[model samples]
Target: MNTRLQTQTAEKGPVSVIAGPWPSYASFRSLPERERWVLYGSAKAYREALEDQGLIMAEGYDDFVRRVTRELEL
Candidate 1:
């Protein structure tokens, strides 16, 4: 848990349970720092480093990114 997951209030509602591992070094490293900062916390992205998995998003994307980056201390 690199960052504390926050409750969301987007159309999809609060945070979802990803129930899997976070991205791997090889997969996560492929993204430019700018892109990595924008993962939607999708189960696919969380487990496999793939973002925008075609489902409704949870938190506001910008908010999610900002919070995650702040917490990651990057």
Candidate 2:
């Protein structure tokens, strides 16, 4: 268990257990950063819409770049 995971778990409660396959790392990474970010942001919205939300998106440094690209549709 990573320290961040521990902290988030403590703050937000337990992690959700997802049953379906997550998007592939390559599919996610190959996307332009901004494009990816937009997609991810939309995905986050979708995730939150669920009655039993389980998605956790803890983005790193590249996250912003990805988000911008996705948002701009570049």
Candidate 3:
């Protein structure tokens, strides 16, 4: 990974995983504010890079999420 990416990921702190299944949005939202900001910042960085590379076209947060969802089939 890129040094900047690694730093950013680390700054976001650790993501705890529950053993059995993925957590819901509500559960995720319950995380500390700093954690949430780190997650959002990381995602924004990635989305900006994808846009720069022409891999994805997104105008803003909502658009970015929609485009990513469509691409990932989520």
List lDDT for all candidates, in order: 0.45, 0.50, 0.45
lDDT of 2 by residue, 42-66 (tens): 7655645642455454543266445
TM-score (C-alpha, index-matched) for candidate 3: 0.41
- Model 3: CA > 4 A from native: 1-27, 58-74
Candidate 1 is scored at a TM of 0.31
What are the per-residue Cα lDDT tens digits for candidate 3 across 1-74? 21121112354453322122211234345567666656656666875675464332314558556544443334
RMSD of 2: 7.5
lDDT of 1 by residue, 1-74 (tens): 52334456566575543423333333454566656556434423553342344233335456555655554444
lDDT of 3 at 30: 55
Q: Give the distance in Å from residue 43's predicted Cα in candidate 2 to where it truly belongs.
A: 1.6
* Model 1 per-residue lDDT at 53: 42
Error of 3 at 1 (Å): 29
The backbone clash count of each candidate, in order, is 0, 8, 0
